[model samples]
Target: MQGRTLNFVTKSMVKTKRIPKQARAKARIAAILSATDALLRSSLPSNITTTAIAHTAKIPVGSVYQYFRDKNDILEQLYAEASKQVEELVLAEQSAVDPALGFDHINRTLLQCFWQTARSHPTFGALTRWANREHSFVEVTPGTDSSLARLIMRTFEITGINLPAARKEAVLRISVTVVSAVVDIAFEEDDADKAQTLIDELALLLSGYLA
Candidate 1:
């Protein structure tokens, strides 16, 4: 998980002019991010501009530039923050799962966690979609510690499943890829019920495979 998280952060880091040290400066940065998130909910990513973000945030354009390089820089920061939330949510769910209940229960819990995170943050789906389209943000390579794969491996550890290391790595990589693809499509669905159905089906598929 650390490797994959670092990959995103390293790629998306903003080349800011200065880091905020004072409370007021930090608050201004938060306001800028909040305004960008709000704008993303209603408008197309391409249409959003730094001046518009400043206008919405009620801060001067220079202030936006002070902490961020441009609109894309702000969007990258938003993506980085959203990704951190997702990683934390998955890790929390992994810790809460009990191997005694079996892999099916564990699998569903993690899936539900992802769904809840996406639903709670309206900006998440939009930011994810925009990032994928414009920046290839969700591309994870094999051998990297993806959150989904790490969650599965942690389950294995707790359950005493002695799978071979090489095979375990392969299985985890494929599982992460499949789940990531399904999740992307699921979030893209406009209808809430339909989106949930996709997630449920994914849970069943993973459970069967793991079992």
Candidate 2:
């Protein structure tokens, strides 16, 4: 499980025809992803097609095929980009946190950062729902050096919490999984206040378990 999770994170979830190098190529790829993102905001992943994406991106269908084999390949890349954005936001939030703050404060701060990113990207909920159905998003495991686990470990260090290496890994793994589940549920809520309430409850849950 650990090895598989690591591979999914470290390597591309799906292979593209080639990696973009030149500025024009990179811009074109970004446009393709942006087009897909816009489509997902209103359409289900399964309902979207590569030709539709090409039309939205204002490129030829062959150009879309130049980078992606099909719509699923494009969706996988879109999810990967979303995950990368979340990790980057968490890291930025972590840097600004005060070391003097306890686990609860830091946890909630980071959770808010995550929520903000997920909320801003309207495609996230639809993409996640699709990935869950397709079994494309794998469960994260301990010792995969996941971004969440590393951030949690850093939080422990800042708060001066001590535990055996094995025990710490177990706690981190469980905490990440629980937070992910709660956040997913929160994202599914149509009401803003209800979604935030779910996140607040999650902060309390983690405080009791980790702090």
Candidate 3:
């Protein structure tokens, strides 16, 4: 009876402390990532650990484990969030409609959106810097599509490009890939003109594919 009572009390406490949903988990994760961003500017990703993140967030290291599997999992969640943020910006700002064809219109818009998003979320650079050189959070999901992929599909459809499902699928991943690469460059470029130049060049190349 005593052992059973102890187990019940422990389990109840654990349940009470559990994060409610993935959203709550993500919120805590975001707080941790923001702390990491600050720390990484002065240190490297490897130097930043669960203890560092929790200290930065002023939360207990033990509690952090409740949400993230580890530091890499935290980094991966940050990557996914960063990608989603950019994707949301593109989707929200889409205003062009072209059925006659050509990716030019969409490319310019996408570049502009990408620039704004990267600027708004400066930590994105640090996240990408860590994600690419070290641990990437990419996972293969069958029949699963990204928001950026859906945006690309919408653009292609608007342009009257009758792309097959496979190609349409490929285009989304391509757009995310290209936009992300530009982000890598944009973050390092201090000059606005230089950043705009890169955007224009990328937009032109993407447009040519449709034209």
Candidate 4:
């Protein structure tokens, strides 16, 4: 879990700039990010501009420039923050899971947390969709796949499963890929019932593989 969290934190740190030092600076940065998040919820990512962010944030355009190099910079920070929240959520669930109860329960808890996070943060889906386009603001990768694999290995370790060196990685990689696709489908669906059905199906699919 720490390994996966560190990967995302390191990746984000490399892309983020203009660290907030003072209280006002921190508040201003938060406002900028908040404004950017709101704009992303309603408008297309391509249509959003730094000037518009500044206007929404009620600050000068120069202030937005002070904290963020550009809109992409803001998007990068948003993604970074979202990654941290997800890592924290998974870790929190990890502590609550009893190894005796097994990975089925653990998987359900984690999946529920993931769905809740996405639902709570409207910008997460928007940023992800935007980041995949041809003129994407930020480079996207399969970072979540490795993160999921690491978390699964930790769970297996806790449960005293004698997973082989070669097969452990292979199983987890395939599990993460398939589960991620299913979750993506859930996120894309408009009907809440259908989305939840996808999540539940993912849980069952993972339990069959992991157990």
**CA deviation > 4 Å runs, candidate 2:** 1-14, 21-28, 136-143
Cα lDDT listed for each candidate: 0.73, 0.73, 0.59, 0.69
lDDT of 1 by residue, 23-141 (tens): 99999999999999999889978899999999999999999988987888898788777777776877887887777987787778878887877677767777666655664434422
User: Residue 183 of candidate 1: its Cα lDDT?
Assistant: 77
For candidate 2, give the lDDT.
0.73
- Estimate candidate 1's alpha-carbon lDDT, on a 0 to 1 scale: 0.73
Deviation in angstroms for 202 in model 3? 1.1
Cα RMSDs of all predictions? 3.4, 3.3, 11.0, 4.2
Task: Tell how far residue 62 is off in model 2, in angstroms.
Answer: 3.3
Error of 1 at 112 (Å): 1.7
Of 1 and 4, the candidate ranking higher by TM-score:
1
lDDT of 2 by residue, 98-172 (tens): 978888888888888878877786676676666556653344232426666677778788877887877976787
The candidate 3 region of ten consecutive residues with least summed lDDT is 1-10
Over 4 Å off, model 1: 1-17, 22-24, 137-143
> In model 4, which residue pairs have backbone atoms overlapping below 3 Å?
none
How many clashes (backbone atoms < 3 Å, residues ≥3 apart in a chain or on different chains) does model 3 have?
Answer: 0
* lDDT accuracy of residue 174 in candidate 1: 67
Q: What C-alpha lDDT, on a 0 to 100 scale, does residue 207 get in candidate 3?
A: 74
Question: Backbone clash tally for model 2?
Answer: 0
Q: Which residue pairs come into collision in candidate 3?
A: none
